[model samples]
Target chain A: MRKLRYRFSSDEALMLAYRDGDSGAFECLYHRHKDALFTFLYRGCGQPNVVEEVAQETWEAVINAASRYTPSAKFRTWLFQIGRRRMADHWRRVPQQESPLQEAAEPVAPATGPGDEDYTAFEQRVLRAVGELPADQRDALLLREQGFSLADISAITGAASETVKSRLRYGRTQLRAQLGDSL
Target chain B: MSRDTRREQGDALPLPEMNSPPQLDEKILAHARARAPQRRVTSRPGWMSGLAAASVVGIAVMITLPGQDGVHDTLPAPHWEARERTPAALSQPEALQADTLTDDVAQDARVDAQNGTQKDAQKGAQKTEGASLSAAPPKAVAAQSSARQSAGGLREEQARPDAQALERKMQAGASAKKIGRASPQPALNAVAPEAEQSAYRTPESSIERDQEDRDGATHQRMIEKGLETCAALLRSDDRPAAISCYAALRKDCGDCTLPPTLDAALEAQASDSVTSP
Candidate 1:
C-alpha cells in the first residue's frame, strides 16, 4: 500500500487506528515488527520451517486481536511474548526434536590460527553457542540485546527478576566456556 | 559476572537478522484487511431531526383542527341512554323555552310576593301556551317530553317548539344556548357539507377507527391485562420487559385512555431508556 497521509505516533496508536477500521495502519505496524519478531523466533528455534510457522502464527494472532488490544504494555513486549508462547507450544508438541543448538551446529574444520579461520564459520560457532544456552538465559540475553529492561524480559518470560538474573549469569558463563579464547 | 562484562557479552554476540518470506506478509495483510472493523456511520444532525419533528407536528395540527366546528364529525354521537341520562335536555329550543319559563315564573313570584293573590284566568292562558310549545317535531318532542318528565319539578309552564321552528330559533341568535343542549342530529344539520369536509384519511386511520369501534371494549380489557403484566415486571425490576410491555401498549392501544399512572410510567421509561447508557 502507498504511504498514509496520517502518521501514527506509536505502535499502540497504529494498532488502535487499525482497530477502528483503518487496515493501512496495520500494514505500517506489521512492517515495523515483522523482521524483529522473525529474528527472535529464529534465534530461539533454529529450524526454518518452525521459525516461519511460529512467526506467521504470532502475526496472525496480533491481527485477529487488534480490536481488543489495549496499550497496557509496549507493543514489542506483547509481540515477543506471543512469539515465545508459540515456540513453547511447538516444543510441547514435539518433545523429541533435536535441540536448536545441535540442529544448527556444523563441525569446525581444522585451521592454523584464528586470523586464517573463516569469519562465516566463526559466526556459525557463535550462533550455535547462543542457541546452546538454557532457554531462560537465552531469552534474557536476546531481550537484553534488543534493549528491553530486565523487568520487560521478566514479563515476557514469566520469570521472577532474581531468576532471570541468575539465568543470564549462568548462560554467559557457559557461552564463554564454549567460545573460549576466541571471545 | 559484572554488569560491564554482561554488557560486553551482549554487545559481542551476533544478533540474528531474520526476515519472513514475502508470502507470510501477504497472508497476514490479507487477514487484517478482511477482519478490519466497519466504520460507524454518522448520526443525522440534531437540527435536521428537530425540523422533521416540527413538520410532523404542524401536519398533525393542520389535519385535526379544521373540522372542529362540526360537532357530529368530531365527538362520538351520544347514545340515547347517555342523552336520556344527561340532566339537561339535548334540544337548544327547549332550553330557550325553559329559560323563558323561568323568567315568567320569576316575574309572577315577585308579583305574588308583593300581593298575596294571582289572576286564575291568566295562569290558565300561560299553561295552554306552554302545552302548545311542547308540541314539537317528533325527536325534539320526545326529548322535550322526557326532559319535562325528568324535570317535572322544574317549571311546567314552559312551551316547547318542534325541530324546524327550533332550528330557526337556533339560526336566530337564541342559538347562544349552552353546548349542553346541542343534540347530535341538530348539530349535524347546522354544519355546512364543505365545513364537514375533513383532511384526507390514511388507510390506517380508517382501519383504526373501524377496528376501534368494533373491538373497543376488548382492546380496553387487553390494555388492562397488559398494564397488570407491566406492573408485575416493574415490581420485579425487570425494566426491559416493562419497557417492552409499554411499547406494545403504545402500538396497540394508542387511542385508548390509559390510567395516568400507567401513562406516566411509560413516559418515564421512554425518557430513561433514551438517557441511560
Candidate 2:
C-alpha cells in the first residue's frame, strides 16, 4: 500500500517525504531519475568509470541535501544541475584529454535509400556528433532534449536564456553538418 | 520558439540508456535510511504539571493547619467532661442546698419568735451547747457566738413583725456553706484567728492546700461521672458504648482503679461479646 502511494507521488512530494524520514520515498525518487541522470553524466563525461563516480557523488550530494531541499524548480532540473556541477568538479581535478568521440567517429555514410542505410551506424554517428559538441553547447542541448525549457537549461547551467539558446542552436547546427544526408 | 521549430532545430541523437549500479543503489539507500529523521518523543501533558502543583498545595495546606481530629483524639475525655460539668455545679449549689435546709431554719425561726423572752435564755443555753460541740477554743467560740447574737438582735430589732429576716439570714448562711463546699478558700478564711495563727499554716500554704483539695475533688467527680456513664450504657445493653466509655475512662484517668463490681461486669461483657461474635 505504501509503495503504491510512493510510486504515484510527484518528484517534489517524494523529496519532501525523504526530507521527513521516508527512505522509501527517496528510493522511488532515485529509481525514477537514476537512468536519466546516469545517461546525462555518461554522455557528458565519455568514460564509464568517471561517469559512475560523478553519478555516485551527485546522488550522495542529493541525499545529504534532502533535509535542506526546497521545491524551487523541477526535480530533474535540480538533479541535472548537481550532476553537471559534479562533472565540472571532476574535469577540474583531471584535465580533459582527447575527445573520446574523435576515436569512435567513422567515415560519413554515402547518400543512399533510407532502407539500405545502416540505422545503427547512423545512430552511433549522431551520438558521437552530440558528444563532440562543446561542453556548454552539449549541456544546453542535452538539458533541452531531457525536456527542460530554455529557461530551465539556463537555470541548470547558470547561463542566461540567450546564452542557452545560442549554445543549443550552435550544437544542433554542428550535429547536422557532421551527420549529413544520413540525418 | 514553437515546439515544431524547437524540435526541428535540435539534434535527433539517440542517447544510450544508463543506470546506477546495484551496489551503488544499496550503498546510497542504506546511508539515507541510517540518516533518516527519528520520531521525537511527545512531551508530558500540560494538565500533569497543574495536577502536580495542586497536589503540592494540598499537602502544604494539610501540613500548615492544625488537625481537628488530633486535638479531639489527644484531649482527655474525663477532664473535658469535668470542665463541661463545672459551670452547672458552681451555678446551682445554693439552690440545691437551700431546698434541703429551708424547712429546718423556718421552724427554728418561728419557734424563737413565739418565745421572745424565753428565746434569749434558750439561745444562751443553745450557744453554750454549740460551743461545747465545736472544736474551736471555748473563748473563740464564745466570741463568735456573741458576735452572731449581736447581729441577730440588730436584725430582730429592724424587723420585729415577722421571722422572715431570721429565715433570710439562715438561707444566707446555708448558701455561704454551699459556696465553701464548692471552693475551700472562703471556709479556710472563715477559720478563727487562733486556728489560722498555727505554726504550720501560713496564708500561702493554706491557699496551696485549698487548690490541691479542689483538684482532688474535681478528679474524683470526673471518675464518678465516667463510671456512672459506663454503668448506664451497660444497664441499657449497649455493649459497644459501654466498652468504649470504660476504655475512655481508663485512658483519661490512668491512675484510677475501677470498683470490683464494675470491673467484673466489664470483664463479663467483654467475654460475652468475644464469645458471641
Candidate 3:
C-alpha cells in the first residue's frame, strides 16, 4: 500500500491500535484501501457471488489478523494475497461454470429419468473439455484468467516460482488446443 | 513480478464499485468477538460492600440534580440538544399557537407580579399602601399591555434570524462557513474551502438540530423535505453524495445499509424456497 503523510499515525500502527479498540484506526483502514481491494476481488472471482464472498472473507481475515499481523510487509499485499487464495479455493470447490453450457443443456436430476439424455450429452461435452487439461495446468490457467499473478499463484498454492511458471506455460498451451477456435 | 505479463494500467486491477456480503461482515465480527479472550479478575465481598456504598451515594446525588447542569450530561442526555433548542421551537406554527404560548408566559408573569403585590399589601402599615397593593394586579396588566406593544419593535428579533440561517445553509451548503446559519455570509465565506466543505458535508446536522428542537408533524414534514432533497442530490450531483446517502440512510433506514450481497442473497433464497416448496 502507498503511504501518504496522513495526520496522527502510521497505517500499521493505526491498525494495531484498532485491534486494541480504536475505531478511528478502522476508519482509516477502510477509507484507505476498500476500493482497490474490492476491485481486486471482483476480477479475481469473476462470479459476483464468489467475488463478494471472497472479499468479505479476506477483510475478515484482515480484521482478525490485525492484532497479530506483523509490519514485515505491506498490509495490502498480505490482504490481496488472502483474497487470491480464497478465490482460487472457491473456484476449485464450485467448478468454473459458463452460461452458454448451462443454457445448451438444461439441468436434470439423475432421479428424473432417461428423458434428459440430450441434456446429459451436452453436459458431458463441456466436462470432457475441462477434463482434457491436466489438473495443475487447469488451475494455473484459471487463476491467471481470474487476474492472479504468477507470484500470486505461487503464494496461493505454496508452489515454487519455477513450478508455477512451467505449469502456467504448459496449461495455456493445452487450454489453447482444447479451446481451439474459441481461443 | 512475472516478466512479459505486464498489461495496461487499467487492466492490471478491477475497479471496486459494488459491495460485498453483509452476512460475511456480521459473521466475521461475531466470530472475532467470540474468540476475543475475556479479561479475568476476582471480586471480594469486603470490597463489594464499599463499592455499593459509593454507588448509592453517587446515584443519590445524580437523582437529586436537575441534570440541566450536571456531570451526567458529559455525553448529554439521550438528546439534550433536541431539548435545549426546544424553547426556540415555540416560534413555529401559526402565529395563533405561538401567541398562545406567549400568552401563557405573560399569564405566569402577571401571576408573579400579583403575588408580589399581595405580599406588599399584607405587610403595609398604611391604608394608602393597602390601596396601592390593590393596584398591583392592574399594574401587572399594564406591564403585560406594554410588553405586547413592544412586539412591533421585536418582530426582527423573533423571526428573521432562524429563517436566514436556514436559507444560508440550504443554498450555500459546502460553502456554509459557519456551522451556524445566522453567521454572516462574509464570516461563512471566510471559512477555508476545506472547512466550508466539511461544514455542509452533513447538512442534516443543522437540520437535525432544527428538527430535534421541535418534534411535531410539521417538523417531521420538514425533515422529510430535507431527506427528499438529499435523495434527489444522490440522483443528480456527485458532490457530498456519500454524506447525502448517509443522511438518507439515517433518515429512512437508520444504520442498516444492506450490502449489495443482500439482493443476490434474496434472489438465491427465493430460488431455493421455490424449489423446496
Candidate 4:
C-alpha cells in the first residue's frame, strides 16, 4: 500500500512542517508573509537600511525558534513579535533619525491636478502623518492596518489590550489633525 | 466616535512597501533547511511530558524494591512470622480450628495415658490396705467394684473422664453406707451414732452431713469459677490468647456454654483475611 502524505496550509502548520525537515513548507510560509512583514517594518521605522536589517533578523529569529513554536497564538502574531523586538533593538543601538513629517515637508515631483496625483499626495500625507506619531501609536496603527485584532496587537506588542486600544485612538486622532481633509 | 471606528479609519490608509533585501530571504531559507534535519526535540506537549514523568517514577520503584538477586548462599524459606504479623493467606478459621484441635487431642491423650498408669499403681496399693484392715459388706463391695469396672471400660475407650469420675464417686458413697451399717469396728464407731444408721441419702438432717454437703458445694463452685475464667478470656479481643482459650474449652470443658459472638468474630476474621488477598 502507498503511504499517505499531508499538506501544510496555515502559517503555523507550514512552520511546524519546516521544523520537521520539509524545506518546501518554510519557502511557502516565507513567500506568503514576507511582503506584508517588510511593509510593516518599512512603515514602522521609515529607514530602508534599518528596516531591511530588522526584517532579516526577525526571519532569522523565526527560523532559530521554530522548534519551540507552539500554536497558542496565531503564527502572524509570533512573526510580528519577533519583528517588533528586532526593530526595538535596532532603535536602541542606532541614534534616532529625522522624523517622517520632516521628510514629507521636503520637495518632490509636482502634482498634476486633483486626479491620481492629488490622491497619491493625499496617501503620502497620510503615511507621513502616521509615521510622525509616537512609536507606540505608530506601531498600533500599522498592526491594525495589517488586519491584526486589538488582542493580537496587544500580544505582539507586549502591552495590555486596553492600552493597544488607547494607542490606536491616539494615533488616529493625531493622523486626522495632521492630514486634515486628506484623512 | 468609538476607538474601533477610528481604528478602522486608520486601517484604510495605504502604507508604502519596502521589501526585504533579496539576499536576506536566501540566507534565512538556507539556515532553515540546514537546521531542520538536525533539530533536537527539546520541548514536548503536556501529555507526553506527563507520561515520561510517570514512567520515570515506575522505574524508580522497580529499582528500589528488595530481593533483586536470585543467587544467594542461603535462600529463606517461605513461611509467615506469626508474632511479627498475621498471615494474610490463612482465610479459613476452620483450618486453624482443625489443626489446633488435632494438637490438643494428641496432648490430652498422652496426659490421660500417663494418669491412667499412675492411678493403676495407686489403686493396687489402696486395695491391699482396704482388704487387710476390714472386710466390706459383699453387696456394697460388688456395687463399688462394678462401678470401677465400668469406669475402666470407658477409660479404655478414651471416653470423657469427668463423667466417669462422677459415676465412681456416687457408687463409692453407696458402698460407704452399707459398710457403716454392717461394720461395728472402732473406725466405724468413730462416726456419730446417728451417722452409722444413715442410708447415704442426699443432704439429710445432720450437722456433719450438712458440712460435707457444703464442702461438695464449694468444690462445684470452684469448677464453675474455672469455666467462667476460660469463657471470659475467650470473649476478650486478645486474639492469640482467645484462640488458646478455645482449644482449652474443647479439651477440658466440652460441655461449657460458648457465646454466639465467638462464631461471628471467627467468620469476620475469615472474611477479612480473604478480602485482603
Report the C-alpha lDDT of model 3 over A92-153, residue by residue, as the tens digit: 78757642122222224332222335445433333344345665664555456445677876
Each model's TM-score? 0.47, 0.46, 0.30, 0.44
Give Cα-based local distance difference scores for all models.
0.62, 0.62, 0.46, 0.57
lDDT (10s digit) by residue, model 4, range A9-92: 778888777777677788888888898899898777666767778888898888888777777778889999899889889878
TM-score of 3: 0.30
The better-scoring model by TM-score among 1 and 4 is 1
lDDT of 1: 0.62
* Deviation from native of the Cα of residue B148 in model 3, angstroms: 99
Model 2: residues >4 Å from true position, as ranges?
Answer: A100-118, B1-11, B39-277
Chain B: TM-scores of all predictions: 0.20, 0.25, 0.17, 0.19
lDDT of 3 by residue, B13-107 (tens): 11123454556545655555554433234567698899999999999997896534421233223222322333335332222232323332232
DockQ of 1: 0.26
Model 4 CA deviation exceeding 4 Å by range: A1-8, A100-114, A118-121, B1-11, B37-277
The complex in candidate 4 yields a DockQ of: 0.26
Sorted on lDDT, best first, the list reads: 1, 2, 4, 3
Give candidate 1 misplaced runs (Cα > 4 Å).
A1-8, A105-117, B1-12, B43-277
* Candidate 1, B2-74: lDDT as tens digits: 4356646655464446787898889889988998877556788889989999999999997887544433343
Error of 1 at B232 (Å): 91
